[model samples]
Target chain A: MGKNKKITDYDMEQLIGQVLRYGVLTSGIIAIIGGVWYLIQSGAGFPNYTSFSGEPARYTSLTGIIKGLTEGSAKEIIQLGVVILIATPILRIVFSLFSFILEKDRLYIVITLIVLLIILFSMFGGLKV
Target chain B: MNILLFTLILLLGAYLAGLAGSLTGLGGGVVIIPLLTLGFHVDIRYAIGAALVASIATSSGSASAYVKEGITNVRLGMFLEIATTAGAVIGAILAIYTPVNLVAILFGVMLIFSAAMTLRKKHEDALQEGSKLSYVLKLNGSYPTKEGEISYKLKNIGGGFSIMTIAGVLSGLLGIGSGALKVLAMDTAMRVPFRVSTTTSNFMVGVTAAASAVVYLQRGYIDPGIAFPVIIGVLAGAFTGSKLLMRINVKSLKVIFSIAITLIALNMIYNGINHKF
Candidate 1:
């Protein structure tokens, strides 16, 4: 309650430091989770494109790398696209949260809440792509 | 196509993209998109989806450091994110239905513009006063510098927000990191200090990407295989860039690389014009 404790008087650098610490931690956890999920789902094999598989089933072939990722069924590609889009952002959000915590900034808590709300709304909105 | 090999290639691309992109401050999209389309022959749409995911990863990795260093304005970034996110949702929905050709054309045009923007020089020793909106939104801060401490005031919060809306739409639609536009909005339009502007732009980018990412996810654009390796690479690249921030001559690199992006954008437009599938 002291006059010296005004909100405007708080150090920006201190807040930022807290944000960085918590942000990295938050992102690291999400990345670990998402990376693990992707690894598990794709198996040890590379994520192959359905259209590029052809009759030869070439894995080690140099030409196969370009062929497989480029030419895939739209449906399959779309599925992959969505997964990539969602998981990375969540990882980043978790990281940002960690940064905020590291900075000891309460502001990011609210920002995180808003982000959560946006995610929920986006999830439920029934609009794809 | 061997799954293992494709993953390995993407992992290498991601690593290089992260390292080089960060060193140049352009994010990994410049390298990632071409690698996917030209190198991997990825469909533009899928390539964009992958690029967007990687963009989020790069920003997330680096933005945290920038933010902690007092270079990013969390309040300013959060305030503008509202606009960007709203625009992103709308853009993502549009991206799903927009003819692939149109998106390709737009993407190309955006890349050209981004290149032009990147070539501009930074204005130092010119910290302007805060705008009326900045006063209302409380957008102001300081940063450490060789010259000692430099405090800056936000100039055009509303204008920056407006630009962010457009930037968000583009991010969702094209899968390119809208960092250039975000920086322009914060730096030129809003007249925020350079470091603050760049860091804040970085802070907000993930959220912008997230907005579209969710929509893309619902629309089924994310592939686990592609997303995984790309993320791994971009995160690595971003880390490398941050470590080498002091040593790198980012401006010169951006100049050289912007031309590369312009070429890709032109080719993309050509492909879009004659798209088969």
Candidate 2:
């Protein structure tokens, strides 16, 4: 009954609760650091939210972002921080999946995996009209 | 000089929007978008992207609080997410091709529903029995209220999932939290306890927004310069508002704010039709 005992005591609520709280807290700190850094660099002028343009080719992809990070650009760091914030929920889902697996819940494992697949497909499908 | 001034204004406005949004139980996008477009003459697309950042920030921030209290039904939220994520991806992708007028009009319709839902007296407070789908998925839970720990049932799983998908698409297309639509689904269509629905919806909104945001991110629609202050301001505002919820007669305030948001949604429609851009 060790496995059964472990399943009941695993305390998914506690585990998931921590994941959410820490995920948000960590992301918040990262965003603030990036935001303040950008604020100082921009001087006193207002940001132009008037236009929509694709990011410059030099900063277009993940590689571009990594390179910019190495250069210590404030903008890249900020972008990276936002990316982390966006990833937080997805992280929670993955954590939940693992928890289900540990509990040996066959039904939940499949359900969680299906949801995970849809999210991944949405994120990566690039099927825009 | 101008950039700094704009930054300050956006920061302050987003802070206020976040505050008002949380206070009224209406997420921040409606407030941020109107302020951006009508107040600052920003493009709708940029406004949408910035709103997305702000909405996700407040949502994740508050969700952390609610999830800890064990109010959020993690399993239920995940199951319904199947529809929401699929709808969101489609809605966002469709948004890329849809004309601005259509988006604006659809936004107006969405707002009308949001206002109506907000003003309507709370019902569906009774504990529901689990549907067949709920039995299969084991979707039910309880939360501690002033009364006691109330165990509730989940009904209408199919309808709830469908509504969530639509809500997801709107979130993607408009870059708003579209939380109102989600709440409506859970409360009315799904027959879950209102408290449970609200908390679970918050937990789900972040993921729905992220799904749509992926598209925006890839397209370079998100601007770090614009999003940074907006995120910072809204997060601060929402934090303050949440703290203040204890001291205020928040229900009345929410009604007034909901009406104001409805008006702004109308304005968005008008502008979209007239091609104000």
TM-score of chain B in each prediction: 0.93, 0.95
DockQ of candidate 2 relative to the true structure = 0.56
**Per-prediction fnat values?**
0.30, 0.61
lDDT of 1 by residue, B102-204 (tens): 8778877877887887787754554567667666555676667888768778676777889998988888787767888988887788777766777777777
Query: Model 1: residues >4 Å from true position, as ranges?
Result: A1-116
TM per candidate comes to 0.78, 0.92
Per-model interface RMSD values are 8.2, 2.4
Task: Judging by lDDT against the true structure, name the best candidate.
Answer: 2
Lowest summed lDDT across 10 adjacent residues in model 2 chain B is found at B120-129
The parts of candidate 2 lying over 4 Å away from their true place are A1-10, A43-48, A57-60
Q: Taking the tens digit of each residue's C-alpha lDDT, what string does model 2 give over B1-277?
A: 3766777888899898888867766677777777878888787777777777777877776676666667777778888888788888888888888886677677777877788888876554755567777778878767778888788787788888888888988998988888888888888877777778877887788888888877777777778777777877878888888778779888888778778878888888888889874
